[model samples]
Target: MHSAGDPAPPPPGGVLWSLAGDIRGLLMLPAALTLQVAHPAVGAGVDDHSVFRTDPWGRGERSLRSLQLWVYGGEAAAEEGRRLRKLHRTIRGTDTRGRRYHALTPANYAWVHATGFPVYQHASRYLVRPLTRAQERALYREWLQVGRVLGLRDEDMPPTIEDFWPYYRTMLADEVEATTVVRELLAVDAPVPPPDRGPLTLRVALRAAWPLLLPPLARFRRFITVGLMPPDAREAIGLDWTPRQERRLRRFGAVVRVIVPLLPERLRYLPRARAARAAWRAGRGRQG
Candidate 1:
């Protein structure tokens, strides 16, 4: 567990704070997860151990909650980190290549964490404004701080944005693939149930409409999943992106950029983020 001496979570109003909490940030998550499981070891671990196929909504909700905690949960962030490590203790298996893998193997674990940086960088270009060089560097530094909160040592990730790209490119070229999990995640025909959360009325409506909804939903999933991925990473993983798809994505991104900023805080940010921002403001008011 992180002590007082350990690095604090990303401070309020930083690049990570601004992005990670925004509702638009959700658009980037699938791309990051796609990049993650494109690694054979990560793919193997998820295919064998994750409930993603059987319970996609639950798995996604849980993953989202954990991600929110890493940035907005403050002291709870380190505890969440410890919880994740313990959870993955038994998640070991063999990849399609017949090599054994463990979820927490430093390189494997680090790669999963590392995917977020590039995905965030790429997605920001389309969903939000493209980050300035200073903002990009600050985002990387804050990401590293979150990594520390997740119990990653400084050596596990490249030290700076300058060092990170080469490492990312090397992993894309040498380690990533269209593994079983990646294919399933991208597959339009994969059976996924309607979300079971939300009000009873909403849940019932979703269940009734799911059959009709699934096709378009799945296609949209594939679109954003492919479109948001870094071009080099997409090519490395052999996912196709056509010129028409690029134009469509740009149109979609333009709409999102126009709309998202117009939303109020309650509408624009997730629950955890809303609460954290409120608490931080309250604390600052008291200090003043």
Candidate 2:
């Protein structure tokens, strides 16, 4: 199942990019963004230009939409990548400590891009399914293509998926920090968006109950986010990660793995992914 955004599947061993269009990837968003902002430059960029504070969910929504289009959009995805690369070129500034930063810088872009592989790998264990080592490597290679399309050079990416973990671990140990912006993201105090297409009664109930639910939900979000992090990364971000928390997170993941597949397609995937799956299924039927 190929789409214009990501027109070709990874030759055979790549499962990560193949599943990039899955709604399951959203499970990794918090951790991915958290780790990216660990870089002071990325954090500073968001502080200066991103509307995350004012509209957290909206910012995430737009980011995810762009990714979906890039993966499933084909020629349209190329245009979107070009637009992003052009947009990023205009975003340059100095960090608080007088360090200069540019969104288009290969190193900066690569750090954010590299984080996606591990996030997807980790989240897939529960949100969807697991992959073998060969598939993981293939996924990593496929994303290298994505990085190139987004303006990163080959040298900017890790040489292989095997190389990515050491690089990722080093970034966590040496590069990531909890900036003020990251602290705000980890706080998770923003109101949850009400359901987009649920029954009016369900939406109304959720809206009315949200304030009451916010306290526990916020804690749960932080807990899960931290639980998803490695000790070094969690320590860098100053989030607590205890054995008890790990147990709870594991149980939650177990529940999701069992339940998510049972959800209706409308509930399980975003619109573009739903369409892509439908197209893939239709193509498979024709092949059959």
Where does candidate 2 clash, by residue pair?
4-73, 4-74, 5-72, 5-73, 5-74, 6-71, 14-138, 14-139
lDDT of 1 by residue, 118-190 (tens): 9999999999989999999999999999999888999999999999999999998899999988999999998
Q: Local error of candidate 1 at 269, Å?
A: 0.3
Q: Write the per-residue lDDT of candidate 2 for residues 133-191, one digit (tens) a residue.
A: 77677777778777765666778988887787888877777777888777877776755
The best candidate by TM-score is: 1
Q: Which stretches of candidate 2 lie over 4 Å from their true place?
A: 1-14, 188-208
The candidate 1 region of ten consecutive residues with least summed lDDT is: 1-10
User: Stretches of candidate 1 above 4 Å error?
Assistant: none
